[model samples]
Target chain A: MRIKVKFHSLLRLYLGFGEMILELPDRQDITVRELIDELNLRVGKELKNKLLDGDEIKKGTMVLLNGKNILHLKKLDTVVQDGDVVVFFPPGGGG
Target chain B: MKSELSMFQRQIELLGTDCQSKIADTVILVAGIGGLGSVVAESLVRFGVQKIYIVDNGLIDAPDLNRQILYTYKDIGRPKVLVAKERLSSINPSCEIVPMDEKISESFELPNDVDGVADCLDNFADRFTLAELAWNKGIFLVHGGINGFWGQITSIVPNKSPKMKDLFAGVDEERQQVQVIMPTSGIVALLQSLEIVKLICGIEPNLIGKLLLIDLLNYDFDKIEV
Candidate 1:
């Protein structure tokens, strides 16, 4: 299975890349948490910390699975299917 | 004072008399009279909104002049709510400007008559609080945030779309002051005001159940459904 991942705002700056396609071994299911673990490996530790804090998604960072917020679903445990487009971006905090 | 029709002649031409009356009959709450709130309140006044409830506890500082257009150099050191009331009243004396010099917190109470809310708060915590208030009241909320060249606007209709807190879960409240460019703030603020007007006029808002992400630095505008 393959999923397209896109980064925005500071996440793009931290990762140094905007988008990528990750080929995961075909499986019955892959949750967003599992994908983040894979992403942490690719993007390294520094950026991983920016996205997560001890397994919790960092505050201000938004994770959208196929444009829907994963929090509205099952959060980090939300399932991601093949070809799903995942987006991670931090909505600016300042008014 | 200008004739009622003539006062909003330009917008009346665009929205028609019925829709303009809907806009005039609605009451909006604008939280935080700073970069985004200042402009959103002013636009509401200029658009002939009948009433606006503005909340803010900050005083106008010199640095705010870069984006808070409602205040002038003379307004520095004065309470922002008072200045915002004075300026918005001058823009449309007939429009009621109810200013509350207070901060939004868990206990903040929204007026029962408010038809919509504009979340112009600077931090995620306050924004989340405001969203909860809107959801509890079952009113529409238009949220806008900006930092430097990045900004986002989204309209949340309670029970119809994702909650603001759900979208921004785990996001830490900004501890330090964040950089905000004047133009970017103005653009996002106007978009929020536009959403409110569309809500009142029965027009489908652009960002309902979606987030409009803007990157002025790279000139990219993306709308992501949520």
Candidate 2:
């Protein structure tokens, strides 16, 4: 299965890429948590620490699955299917 | 009536007499008279809104002058809501300006007549509180936020869209004081005011259940379905 992930704002600065497509093996269902672990290997620890806290996604970072927030679904445990579009960005809090 | 129409001839032409009348009859609440609120409040008045309720508990300081256009150096120690009320009144005397020098929290109560609420707060907790208040009241909420060259705007129509809290569930509740550019704040606030006007005028709002992400640094504008 393949999924498209897009980064925005500070996440793009941290990862150095606006978007990427990941090809995962089709034998097993992949959750958002496993996907983040895979992303950590490619983006390095500095970016990983900003996004994750002990396997759970860090607060202030929004993870959207196919444009719908994953938090409304199942947090990091939300299932991702083929061709799903995932987006990660930190919403600005300042007025 | 003819004389009054001349004051808003340009906007009346664009929105038509019926829609312009609707705008003139709407009442809006603007939370936080700071960066975004300042501009949103002013735009509402200029657009012929019937009344505006402005809330802010903070006092004007030197740092606020960078993006808070409603304040001047002489207003450094004055309450922001009062300053905004005085300024907005002078801009459009017929529009009623209700100023509240109070902070919005879980215990805050909105007036019964408010048609729409603008969440221009500087923190997520207050934004969440405002959103909940609007949701409970069954009114529209226009939300705006800015950090540096990035900002976002969205409208929440009660019962039709997801709550702001549910959409931003994992966001940190702590206030992160960020450096926001003046133009970015101005742009976001204007967009918020536009949403409010569209809502009151019975036009199809562009951001219901959608988020408009603005990246001024990269000159990119994208809409994401929520």
Candidate 3:
């Protein structure tokens, strides 16, 4: 099983690469936090400081699973299934 | 040529008289008079949107002059809504510009005649409030925002499954003024204006349920499904 992770807006610009497909062998339930940790290991980029502040998503950061925002779900503890596409971005907030 | 034809000749040539008539008949609400709001209202006026209501409570600052085209150096320190109405009217006298000198608070009410709203607000709290109101009012909203070299545009129809507030939930307002450039704000606002025109003209809008994310630094434009 593979979960596709995508970055957008400022996150994409910061991460350089926009996408990563992580293989989760025989894994049925991986939380968003674990995914982020595995993602950092593969990419060798420390996104913890940038994506989160004290275990909560940074003020403007958005974590979406299959077009549904994580804030609507379970935050960092949201369960992820195989083949789910997770997206991240800090939305542009000015006019 | 007829007066209307000569006035909107170039636009009529491209969008056709049918589209032009729709633009002239629709009433729109521009929710801010800042960077994106200024450009959105200006383009809508040029597109021949005859009736519009502009809302803003901020006074123009020297910094706003960088991207807010509706106000000039001489117009600084004046109320944005008043300045915008005057400037928009100067561009097209046929446009009925109504300036609402107030903020988009929970008490704010969207007039029933407004066919669409341009969500050019700079902050998330008010944006969330306005989006909820527009959704409940069954009005279409063309949302645009800019920060630094990035800008985003999306259209939210009342019938759509996802509203702007839903997609942007939990996003806090910026502590300081957001960084925005002229071209980024202009481009995003113009795209939003185009979406408003498309919605008013009975044309299927491209950004409904999709977000047009733009990066001027790299010149990459991506339309992602929301």
Candidate 4:
């Protein structure tokens, strides 16, 4: 299974560009945290902390699956399947 | 000379005589006469809004020239509220343009008769302050926010709507950490202005309780439930 991931704002500085696709094992579903961990392992440490803190997100970025926000849905434990599009946007506070 | 109202003939036809009259008589308060506010204010005046109150404590700088369309080379170093008022008034002299000439602070008080508010401010402190003030007054506040090809617009109807703070828990402190995009501001402000018009005309807004999120890069428009 494959899912698309996005990084925005300073996270973009760490993760670079806007979005990418990841290949995950089919039939082995993972929570949002596990996905970030996978990204951290692949992208390195500096990028992981920007999106995840300790065991949770930094509370600044808005993680959206499809068009719905993850917070309103299931926080980090939200399950991701094949072809799911996950967006991580650190909302700019400048307006 | 053609009637300046001619530009709004199509809109008047849709709103009819009664609602059109109401829209014309309505006054809007725009907090932060920069990026978003400037475009919102300009569009309102062009659409024949009778009066507008622009509040801002910012000055025109070199960096704002990109999307702050109301200002120019000559207007540089001038107060944003003053310049915006001057430009909007020139665009439609029949309408009244009030310059609040101040920052959005704890003391900000909304006029009782203000028809609506456009939250085009650049900082969350001001945005939150103005939203809270408008909500307390039971006024319609159309919030517009944008950054890096992403933007969202929501209409806050005070007690009847979800509080802005509830949707965005702690974005105030993270203000400086975010990125600002030029096109996003214009698009968001246009949507915000349209929301204001719909509110004044007693029409249903698409963004009443929902946030319209636009991802320009992907050309995808999605709504996030507040």
Best candidate, DockQ: 2
Candidate 4, residue B15: the lDDT equals 77
Give me the candidate number with maximum lDDT.
2
| Candidate 3 residue lDDT tens string, A1-94 | 7898988777887889777888988787799988888887777778877888888888888888887889899999999998898988778889
Across B73-126, the per-residue lDDT of candidate 1 in tens digits comes to: 998899999989999998778899999999999999999999999999999888
Flag regions of model 1 displaced more than 4 Å.
A23-29, A37-46, A71-77
Q: What is the interface RMSD of each candidate, in Å?
A: 1.7, 0.8, 1.5, 3.5
Chain A only TM-scores, each candidate in turn = 0.89, 0.88, 0.93, 0.85
> What is candidate 2's TM-score against the reference?
0.95
Clashes of 3: 0
**What DockQ, between 0 and 1, does each candidate earn?**
0.63, 0.80, 0.66, 0.31
Candidate 4 backbone clash number: 1
lDDT of 4 by residue, B1-226 (tens): 2686686788778778777777788889988887888899999987778989888888899888888889998888999888887888888888899898887889878977787899987767677778889888778888887776777788888766677766665353434534556787788888888888888877774677776766676666666555
lDDT for each residue of candidate 2 in B70-93, tens digit (9 for 90 to 100): 999999999998999889989878
Candidates sorted by lDDT, best first: 2, 1, 3, 4
Error of 1 at B19 (Å): 1.2
- As a TM-score, model 1 comes out at 0.91
Give me the displacement of residue B149 in model 2, in angstroms.
1.4
Name the Cα RMSD for model 4. Answer: 4.0
Reference-based lDDT, residue B152, model 3: 80
Rank all candidate structures by their DockQ, best first, as comma-separated numbers: 2, 3, 1, 4
Residue B226 Cα positional deviation in candidate 2, in Å, after optimal superposition: 0.8
Score every model by TM-score: 0.91, 0.95, 0.93, 0.80
